[model samples]
Target: MESLPHQYSVSVNAEKENELETTAPHLPTLLVAPPSQFDGPGDKWSPEELLLAAVANCYVLSFRTVAGIAKLDWLHIECTTDGVLNKVERNMLFTDIVTKVTLIVAEESLRPKAEKLLKKAEQVCLVSNSLLSTKHLEIEVVVGG
Candidate 1:
């Protein structure tokens, strides 16, 4: 049988006054509804923005994680994500998320490996994978330095 890869779980709990709390492997918070400017006070992040930020942040973090695991030295890193919401078919809601990962390495030969690492990171990124199967997702990796 194939062995299991590294795994973890995140949990979210709701508390008083329409507030939500996230726990376990969760890297971010779940703000209460009404949404700051819309009504009540909460974090400045919206649910949609939260999703994008999570995916983008997770991709970059995953890359660094793998790079460290692979014992590769790196320099600068930047990740950008754009989510486009459009109508699918008639009224169906859809989203297309595109991510650009730019990595600055110490040597030119590391470009290929950098791309490989970024790809692997994408495959394993929990948020990215979740969104990929749900909607159209594309990623581009550019290496420099």
Candidate 2:
């Protein structure tokens, strides 16, 4: 929101037989490694997991903004994203990404509005929109305390 073209910077350091150290300005460094699927230790965050996390995080944030602008009252939202990676032609790439969203509202009447906003959030999520994978959204609205 500060400017039209925003920039982000991050640095990653790694040595042979060691986990990667990822850092950004003013943020704590993160240790990441390849996932177990790639024969890694499987105890650290991997690039694939990070990509899915980004998609889920962006969807939640986008929903917060859209719901606020629409003046919709809500209790909480849970977003879960799954990415499918497969061999494409000669390379491995994510072929599909599915985000499942659960929205809690104070009243049943808000269900329709919550569903609408959830879909809108998915449509506007920057991370998912930038991906070349097929994206799917699943919405569930519940009336709760």
Minimum summed lDDT over a 10-residue window in model 2 is located at 1-10
lDDT of each: 0.69, 0.95
Off-target runs (Cα >4 Å) in candidate 1 are 1-43, 89-94, 132-145
Tell me how candidate 2 scores on lDDT.
0.95
What would the per-residue lDDT of candidate 2 be over residues 31-87, giving only the tens digit for each residue?
999999999999999999999999999999999999999999999999999999999
Q: After superposition, how far is residue 93 of candidate 1 from its true place, in Å?
A: 4.1
Cα RMSD for predicted model 1: 4.9
State residue 111's C-alpha deviation in candidate 1, in Å.
1.4
Please state the error at residue 26 of candidate 2 in Å.
0.8
Candidate 1 lDDT tens digits, 18-130: 56665565366655354464575656455556678888899888888899888777787788887765667786233577887777788777777877887888877878887
